[model samples]
Target: MTRTGSPAGVLSIKPFRRLWIALSLSSFGDWLSILALTALAGSLTKGSAENYAIGGVLVAKLLPALIFGPLAGAVADRFDRRITMVVADIMRFALFLSIPLVGRLDWLYIATFLIEVVTLFWIPAKEATVPNLVPKDQLERANQISLTSTYGSAPVAAATFSVLALISKVLFSQPQQQANLALYINAVTFLVSAATIFSLREIPKQRGKVSVPSILKQIVAGWKFVGSTPLVRGLTIGILGAFAAGGAVIGIAKVYVKQLGGGDAAYGVVFGMVFVGMAAGMFLAPRILQEFSRRRLFGLGIIGAGVALALIGIIPNLVIVALLTALCGAGAGIAWVIGYTLIGLEVEDSVRGRTWAFLQSLVRVVLLLVVASVPFIAGVVGNHRLHLPGKNIYRFDGPNAVLLIAAVVAVIVGLVAYRHMDDRRGIPLIRDFVAALRGEHYTLEESTREHGVFIALEGGEGAGKTTQARLLSIWLRDQGFDVVMTREPGSTKMGMRLRALLLDKESSGLSSRAETLLYAADRAQHVAEVIQPALRRGAIVVTDRYIDSSLAYQGSGRELKVGEIAEVNRWATNGLVPDLTIILDVPSDIGLTRFASPADRIESEPREFHERVRRGFRALADAEPHRYLVIDGTQSQPDITRKIHDRVRAILPDPVPPSAEDETSTMPAIRD
Candidate 1:
């Protein structure tokens, strides 16, 4: 799906529609049951059954996943998952609609089991669909936007359904009984889900072995594939751990109302809050994935989930529980996203079928186990009818304790797995920091520097850096070099806001490190957009201040570590270094004299700080003899321009005039 071209062209793909429709419809129905299902079960049976049946039916439904998962996975792998998804939805439609008709408990049990059979295949098919729909490198963003659409729509639809159910309850004799509307509505969603699946055009299907040579062999093969890949195996194990604990938390959430506080309705809030967390996680995931390794993010998500789960047992307040549940949801959402992202990245298009199938099977089996463990754990937790310990009987009331146990285990395993993920660990750490500089190295080297140069005018507060940048731009253009000069911490949208905060005299108590970071973030955008393109087009790329400003001013003047600023700049530019640095050596008093207005925030720094900044610049210049050219900042504007022009000529012969035959060399490739 790496359809690399103009980004707008990629949105035209049809598979996106199918992905959107399926998630929206499925989640909407899932939400209705989220609050209603417990009520439905409670009405159908006595108190014991109400308690056990919810857990029981879930267990029963999930059981087939343990037995039939491999076979279903094989089917999804062998045949067209599109057809499988379509058929599965149709089956769910029939079963959900028919579930309302099943008069006996046995029939209901059978229906529950049957629906999960459909789910076993459906989950994997849906999971595998995204990479097919979007290009490879864009997968993270595509996945992000896709998940956002799903999560964003689900809540709106759920709220609509909740209101509908509430209104129907007032009109109906038995509001609990009328919850069947949700079942029928869910059934319709399945129908809609199926229609969306069917609407997509044919994709190249992956083939799987249908010959029943050995079921054990295929199962073994699936396991082998999972085990062979470091990424898949580690993440799958982590995912299983996360879900197992998460399911426990969900299963016991209703018990919190009975023992702690709130009821089945409270359970709804917990889940709804969790979903809200999903929306938030989807929004922030790109940053996490970009700045941090996938494994680290995955670990953090799990660790957060586990910690929240543990906290629920320790601090058992409804409000706190709600907050933690939301946290748990957010963590889970992040974990889920990372899982999807990793799967898409690790698995090839052809083997994606088997990979997702295997993944889905594992999830189904784990869910079933989570469901099965509930009653047994509940039985163990309750005050014994047969003299079992109260700890054993309290499983329903204290599920988080068990969840906490799971969380602790997950954290330990994740920490170990974290050590093995080597692809990203160190590179991005430095890359982000380097990117914070005004004009990074990549912006310089990649630019065909024959006709253009990126002269980043940089100095302390009231240093006349901006004026010099403009002056240099004018001089360079007159000399026949096309010049582009821009300022740091204000070039891009967020950067401008950051620039205001950094330079504002009124914004007191700003941390030096915070100031340093803001400068880095702004440089990231300028390099990506302004500097790189200009240089690439053979134009002179000049900036007001490059990374050196941060190193000299923030790093040395403000006493922040140069290393830390370097790290931030590195990440921002992907480790790009500037081709040359021309340090404007000016006494702090002379620099201040250049500004007619009162000193802005940073300009008001102590004279000692300004001295350190000037010294820091000179120190950097000394370290890199060839790259840095120091010019007297105290010189008149004309003399200053002449000196800067000489430095430009020394780097590369000054550009020919526009009227000259070589004018084409300075033509701007960049557009506003």
Candidate 2:
């Protein structure tokens, strides 16, 4: 079944639905356990000892990921994922149930560590299972839903803990008893998660043996692959950087709030707002910035977070700081979703588990280091009140300095990752981002309509688009179909005049925008008078030099905004985009060398201009790969023709046979 690229699509699969529910319950229970374990730790200690006990429990939760992550991932890959998850959940259920029954601080810490170790194994298995359960296009939506469920359940768990505390006070009359009840309830959630997973028999078993040497080899191979692949390496670094930024914020949030003249209540509000922003960014950013590349978006998200964090350090107002915190969280959310989606899409299944494990472990370690050191670093930095001229005072504190440093580090890391991972190299990032915001990026679906297939040929000067179009037209006619052979800028009576004006040497001084409009006007006339009419009649309309040529020459070559040029052309053509655009890619020097006669006004431009035009054509082709056929113009003419013909044949409808009467009456003779 074809799945829609929406949240509903993933939910439509029964096994995925069950798995998703299990994940939600498990995550909710995990958070509840954290609160319960901390409360238990406090009960077992007094004075300053309570703080250490609570910190130790939290640190214990993170430490196991560093130690057991690779081994857990190897086990996940070598055994049945369904059994792994179920067994892990069962162990967690028993261990969590014992945490309260045993009632010792050491036992509580040990149980927490064991729970995290079991969770490490469960996580990689679950992460590896998700992609197999959904369609490729729907992976992002699935991840979005999973992340929403994972993080979204935190507030509910917190609220549930609060309510359970109230009920325990009223019924049991002891704080320890209340904490123990919450623990018991959390253990039961694991049991429920286990039962849910047990019902999902669709989870696949491991393909290979689970020997020690094999596990070690797989782990090494996974690390080598991550180090070798540029995209994965960039993703890993960007993800870790994002986590580090978030960790710094979390680690210093309390002190930062205090510096802003706020207390625990204010800190809670800011913390909640961060998650709110995260939810907004994940749920809304993709929809708003639909046309932007995910690679660019991910990098931009990190940069945005860094910028927001820097702004927070400079601003002393608690309200502004809270808003900035939310903004930072939103950016982190976008990066998180895009990064995980890329991993699932780009990484192969063989090493997917290990890759996920490595990512998880690295994130945990970075977070651990950041959390462990930020407080110490803040203490060493100390606080100072700076006096400036004109009665101005700036109070600089440890939290502010830490945040400033984090912001710089995050921005630098983001830039490095962007340089490595950006797919659309050479295009300005700021310009693309602005264009995306202005709604100028065009989607293929928006440009195409249900009609006869329209094919366009595009290239630099003298790349033989006219020849290719003619050959394609004749081939279509020979196959017993009606074919409309045409060219833009001259196909219509009005277009001829505009084309002449555009090409004449006298128009050499025309402004770039004027030249762009002239080309768009010619396209408008050509499409209205010829292309759309033929397409509506179900004829194959093969055109030479369509919208792309204008985009290349007037936009890229002339250095005008491609998005603005595209918008004008889109309006002029009334959204009649070609079904297929075959870009005959040729080097500028080679293409220019083919024009032996005196150059036309546009062709007489510098070699640099022509090179830009050539690159522009290639860039447009790269952007919409499925709609384009980019062939080397230096290839043999017959080979090029054959390639075009094969592609056209795949999409062409069955040919209609000629009528008997029409066949009999075809006796017209040529009069010379």
Candidate 3:
């Protein structure tokens, strides 16, 4: 949820990095196989039957998902994920190798079907295992990388297929032989994938009882959850619709290319461009659109893709078609990434596998129907010519007409999904979009802090923040304000231990990053256990030393990047920002002199460190004047107390009159 960091940060995890490598190799093979199989299918049939044969091959690849999708997730849930992935990869390698060796159309479909069945199990296991591989905060980044690897290799595969095709033409006597080289190479990639997966010991093994009924129950529960959750429902519909349009394009791409007077290479470029666009979109989306509502963005992405698809249907030039295909890919890619991220963030881990499986199953079924039917529809419509007055002829073909219809359907689905799941329904779409572009949008979920007020006192060590927080809470309580006074690093039970570890001089050897993480851990537990509950019940919660302490101390004082520190704390607190932050400004030497006891680990830092911390606090206040107050810490105690009281009064609830309090003296207090 933190928008302060890059998605590439997850790649630093070794296990995930290795898994990403394996996925890349496997995806390369899958893309190459698609090209080889479709080309071979076209070669084996005549003009009219070519479309059907290609559709049949594609259908064979998707059909297993309908039968094995839920079962695959169950298997992933009930078995060892590492073993499942390795076994699936090995089977796929054998099946792929057999495709080239058999040299029969029936064998081709059979092998493709078997490969897809293996893939069904592989995909769920991978998706389920990914959440366990990285920190919860890094899951989105991990998905971005994994998905990018999944499709980013398509361009490379297309180029490889083209090169292999030329090699076969020079090396063989028959057109059927042209695809053999690519298929054989594809088989090798799977073997490499299997080896990579087999070596990964990090993937957790599933434990506990498992059975057919349990699996079925889980599947049913997943579906029920999907239906009940508007976010999931919209994501499901949007993703399926997007893929349906994509499948239609894939089904007729070969024939469409032929109609444009293009050969296999042209088709390969067209295919490659789509994924190129996908990779670009996935890479750019998080960076550029982080401010937008993710739910709304998912729908908009689908709509954008549909518009691009419609343009593709109307455009005549192959170059233009390729460009539009890339644009379509970009929109779909954004939707795809956002959809998966939302699921991971919102769905419980216990049911995540089944949820993913249910969605995958539905998506595959939709793709199969669209892919199988679109090419046939194109063939039926064939080509038509209409004469105009000035010897001009307009041609309307099946591919064009089918694409146009699919585009319209996709657009409608996007609109419905957007409206159904829109979190910012009342906010104007254009206004929110413009704000997002300016990077000033409030991207957090609507705040539940309506009834309560949150205030934090932050400053360098020994700057009297604790004293000020105490005085302010006392003042608010005297005025009949429900005030909860707390301090981070010691507010809750868990935070107390962290506070001891952090402030003890004996722990001086702790690394700066470790110290920062410890503070964040304390703050997270404090917010969840102490602060949030008090705030929810309409209390004016006053906290001493919140997020700004970390940003100032670990970030600037320890010379760590402020943005990185902010990102960690933002996720830790679930984007909970205090309504007001008061910084008691004082010079480091003067502030340190106020401490009577032996200096703690942080307080004992050199003058330069504390100076940097002070500067950090001032900089933060300067940047957000509306949310911050900087008071001179050297002021008289009563003057400082009065200054804090004046600011606190602005956010406090209306004070109860003496007459009203006397009238309700015997009655039970009704709190919001």
Candidate 4:
């Protein structure tokens, strides 16, 4: 059966579920702590100094990343992830508990700095450990769940803080004491997280081999990798840009709310709305934009955020500002998930921790700069009142100016990043975006194929692919159209040699990776030498096997990641997908029985292998029914061929000559 890694399916893994729960609790605590900390900073001073004080607190929280972020990834790599997380959580618990008890601004700064230092190490370890907790197929879904839990807890945290604020009002008169209840709760959550992480045995233990030179080398290598890889570079820029936009909103939110004649409760609601939007974005992205290219999606998300932020600055109403903030959060949320998922899939385990640390470090640095400076800048610009003729007054202050400027910068960042990493360059953005909204995968019509058709027949061992291919080619040729019939693994001169080595039963001990690569190489040559050339000349290019065959036979049958295989094939074929892929579906046993000759190297595989291949085809077809035609191989040869022909005719290029159309109507039925 085809595996659908839904949210429920991913959460069903016991260890992952535990980790997710722990993360949720930890995230709730972290969000609650942020509110308490910022509120405490605001309470520490009055008037213009409040912005400065809040900026100082944020700077303290993020400054450690600049100093220690590079080494944190190496720490995750060189130590046990579980132990690292547990220890960090314990440290944070103590630090948070001391904050309210100390009741001093200096102590708050010191504790905040220390908390961030511990967190820098904890985050990399946590992010790197996640991939090991679930199956590869479920990795993306797992990330969606993890991120949802992390940010989804924000609203809960906000609600809890609001309740505590009310309780503190009745119980205590001091401003510092008002935040004490929330701080104590935050401290308790870290302890809970520590205990939960201690129980998960699934997080793989890393080698504790530590050396100064090795550490330095890894840090350098990590930087080099980020700098050298275009995809990584673009993703880093995109993610940082998204966070900068978010951070600007966060930094000014408290004071901006007050400026709109709102109090702490309104600020809490605004904060909660951002997370609500983030949660909604994470939950809905996969379903709504499932067919959209992730690269383009990431950029679009950032642009949407920038647009919303611009509006947020211009709109004066508190309720509308909150709604706009949610929209901004939604965009940032989409970009965050896609960017992280791409990194997880692209980065290897050995360097994964370091890569995450690098990204996290930059994110913190961006947040630090944005939060530390934007508020101060807003204070510098101060508030201004514009009077209208009808006795209406509009407030256009430093916050509004700052937000508009940040929005422009964010949009530019998104455009640059999009241009750097876009895979579908010639495709129109608006057309593709609309198609994605409608749940369609749109590929720009290739200019090379003036009137050509590309078709592939895919199936198991004896699914009559060869017979169908021959009959289809003859029928098309009889209609006065040029047809090039081909098959993979023996389609070209290089493929002929590859076919012998691949199919010979004596070729034992051939590794799965080697076999996959060999098939890719053959397909690469087949497309370049025969397929593309035929299609460019406006001929009907029919092939017995194509990219899908490798996806089924090697990807699913060998238990390799289908996505990895698809990526390889996509590169090999230069992103040339068939206009139509016909899968001759049949039961493995029945298909095997039809093969008269002794089984080849592939066919000789156990019955279970073929079953996987069959399921893989069905899954592929199910994913894109618009581009596939699945036929029962058990049907009469004539019946199958007629069905295939009808489907092919619908997609064929128009402007058929009058004689060709006349002959097509009178065409004889295809035979096997």
Q: State every prediction's TM-score relative to the real structure.
A: 0.53, 0.57, 0.60, 0.65
Kindly list the per-residue Cα lDDT of model 4 for residues 157-267, writing each as its tens digit.
988887887887788887668778888989999999999999998888973333222333444556865753445677878888888877887787777787787656677
Better of 1 and 2 by lDDT: 2
Query: lDDT tens digits, residues 343-403, model 3?
Result: 7644445567788867765666678889989877887888888797899876779888888
Models, CA RMSD each:
18.7, 13.9, 16.9, 10.0
What's the CA error at residue 235 for candidate 1, in Å? 2.7
Runs in model 2 lying further than 4 Å from the true structure: 1-19, 32-55, 70-87, 90-108, 124-148, 155-188, 194-233, 254-272, 291-294, 313-319, 340-358, 382-398, 421-432, 441-672
TM-score between candidate 2 and the true structure: 0.57
Which sections of candidate 3 miss by over 4 Å?
Answer: 1-20, 68-91, 120-148, 166-174, 194-219, 345-353, 388-390, 423-428, 431-435, 438-672
Q: After superposition, how far is residue 452 of candidate 1 from its true place, in Å?
A: 22
Local accuracy of candidate 1 as per-residue lDDT tens digits, 163-197: 55565566667634555676777789889988887
Q: Higher-TM-score candidate among 1 and 3?
A: 3
* TM-score rank order: 4, 3, 2, 1
Residue 553 in model 4: shift from native, Å? Answer: 21
Rate residue 285 of model 4 by lDDT: 78
Local accuracy by lDDT, each model: 0.65, 0.77, 0.81, 0.81
